[model samples]
Target: MPLDPFLADKVHLLDGLDWPQVQNDPQAAARLGEYLRDPGEWTAPDVSVEDRTVPGPHGRIPIRIYTPATEPGRALLWLHGGGFQGGDLDMPEAHQVSAELSARASALVVSVDYRRAVDGTHYPVPVDDAHAVWRWLGETLRLRSGPSGPVALGGASAGAAIALSTAIRLRDLGQRRPDALLLAYPFAHFPNPALDADTRVEMEALPPLLRFTTEGIESMVRNYVGRLSDLPPSAMPGAADLRGLPATGIVLAQYDDLRPSGELLERQLGEVGVGVRSYLAAGMTHGHLNRGPSLKEVDRSLDFLAAVLADGAAAPAEHPTYNG
Candidate 1:
């Protein structure tokens, strides 16, 4: 499939633009925003939402909690993507996704406002924040016990990287792991796997602003970890020992440069005997979840995630892997 018609119609907005410049130029940024904007009218779902902070190593970590009107079947800690230096709990990827998942799966959703890899902040800060919240939620909500239902740790793009690192930390500490892991278009590997010929050709048709160039990926890694040399395996778990990790659900955007990373993660998890469920969002670019559920593909992606959460919650020990 090609790019979503909704996005294809606006690719002209990103003509001849690069991502780095968009950050400094208001007009360039606005045009990129226009290209990615959702045109549909969206209404917030009926879920109880609250903003609160939890104690962390650096300081208090901010988080948004959403509870469904009905009894929640499970709990999820979700992080939104923005490379590694951007994004917040207010983004639709964090806000709307949490709200909709809370209602759709009848699950308690907590969206973390973890520190970004900027302003002298680097590796372990963001991962530490996510781990702190996971521990807090486990203690306060009794997530480890079955009485409170299953618990999952999930995120999109860079957020997904943080979530996976936190999970690895828990595994190393011998702490109770999350019942499941939900990742969306994850940036799990440094020097991400090469794109196939077909994907490379398709990506060539996309605007530079819409694609993750090698330079951009390298910059993101450098910013997050300072120096790429002697990088921690847990920081990019694609190369780490993933044997003890919990069952995982990965959502890959069909037209994304990072899709290879997510696919590699799926194979890695399976090779380690970890059950995995992966969904490919056809005709979609990276970070589609950030657009909210207004687009059909976005809605379908959310539905797939909700179903994965529900399935994991219902049978934590019986998750089936799709290696092919």
Candidate 2:
């Protein structure tokens, strides 16, 4: 559980700060936005980007579409992460991850620009945006492909939390377990000391320290869920009974504090007899999936997700349940 010397050596420790301190500082959360803005003009030629929107409860929500050369007949519903406070579909990582998966699996990747909590969106608002986009895909876009490779949901950090709840709800409603789920440095654990020592160290290694702080996480959780529940899966993945969930591929950073949550979620999934694949990328930190330099791991995760989801469509006829 030692601090990632690579990260610790490169950055300053995040002394516990009050929620207002991190939120009002502005510069704290602004760093990620700055990074996104300066992500350079680099882009894959095979990837195509387009702007779109879907009707939501309050209003229409914007989104970005990344599609491959050939439509694989399945789409990935991606929710961009910003602690539910910051971030957009145009985020550098969001663009890259969506495009990477698109090219890898030849499926459509839709990134949602939901209402952020920074302006008091809170829980169900963002979660509702996710539902609106998903419903649009199901009803309008028609995500069903012979029921084998239906739509899947995924995201990072706060977005991952929203995706987890959305997927769980989808399964319980008997709609369809996403063919597959790709979660990177997923924010699973809530503000509790239940985490192991190693997990704590890994989370600290993540850059943009202010966004993932103790209070910052709580603020996101509070904003997402109006009132706290005894064990609300809406905020904490571990709180959910993951039985019947989709085939899950969790991409975690070895040095990320959130790493334990991924492993724990995997363990819980296994306990329920759900097929789970867990990948721990070495020398990486939370959000490393988007860090330009750490793209090697991110690429690996996307490739695996492509295969996993595509396999749902290509499964042997007998076991064609499409546990994607």
Candidate 3:
């Protein structure tokens, strides 16, 4: 499969700047805060986007809500990616996709401020924050206009992984899980260096549009989880039982090292009769989806997501606004 030309160009374009430069980026931190502090130009005029906080074990868990013009309160949850270490709800890369989801899916998007790994081990911090938010939304949020319709969940990279864990946890507790799941190059599983050769090769290419590398993935896992045993289905949801889960949309990057895991995740869920579908983005890499307007494949993914959220597995959307 050939790569989308729009994304191919951005790889070269972004290469001009060093990834390491943004490795522990101060600018990245700033971008994460921009959506909360200013909220300017981050949303469309037809939609309402705002920041709201919910009570968490840690104190106040902040979430940014983006609602389409039609509904005051539709249900949706979006998580951002940053290796479980750093990411803000306001980062342009993070908010852009949420904004796109709001406009295209016609649902409200809530991006959470789950704690990062800057201080300790994986579960209790990031996962705890996510779990707290999940429980609160289901038990306390006081959702209006009837039962929560299409409580879809989605995220990118690490956020995708967290989203995976959150869904698994919700289902395990016999709580209502997201009506559907969308995971883009989800950081679902560790390399498992133990996989057979055939499996290893397949896992090597993620969505490709997202620009993931075995090396890059290794770094994120090492920085966040530390070791294989330390990881959890609460963290690596793919490692957990996916049976009886919600309808799922798994988006894989063509060039990402985590591709096979995402595929494996889809297979596992499907085996459990958990209606599932996957989109193999031709010629894209890890991190490509975050580029937003810079890549058409990203737009396609957003539209595909919107269509699914609004219409279910009816058909692939040709554009962002398609309601059919």
Question: Best by lDDT, which number?
Answer: 1
Q: List candidate 1 stretches off by more than 4 Å.
A: 143-147, 313-324
Give TM per candidate: 0.93, 0.78, 0.79
Each candidate's number of clashing pairs is 0, 10, 22
Question: Tens-digit lDDT track for model 1 on 170-287?
Answer: 9999997999999999999988899999889979988777788888889999999987778899888787789889888888999999999999998899888888878788889998
| Candidate 2 wrong stretches, greater than 4 Å | 1-41, 143-148, 192-195, 198-213, 227-231, 312-324
Give the least accurate 10-residue stretch of model 1, judged by summed lDDT: 313-322
- Report how far off residue 246 is in candidate 2 (Å): 1.1
**Rank order (by lDDT, best first):** 1, 2, 3
Query: Top model by TM-score, which number?
Result: 1
Error of 1 at 174 (Å): 0.7
lDDT per residue as tens, model 2, 1-324: 354344445345334434465578776555434533322344573877899888989799998888677755677888877777788776755887788777777777889998887655566677778888888877655534422255778888778878888888777788755767777677777663245775555454345453355665566677666545564665576688888887777666666545666777777888997777656665556676565434445555555556655654222333222122
User: Which tens-of-lDDT digit does each residue in 157-190 have in candidate 3?
Assistant: 8888888887877777887777787778777777
Angstrom error at residue 76, model 2: 0.8
Off by over 4 Å in 3: 10-18, 21-45, 139-143, 146-148, 192-216, 313-324
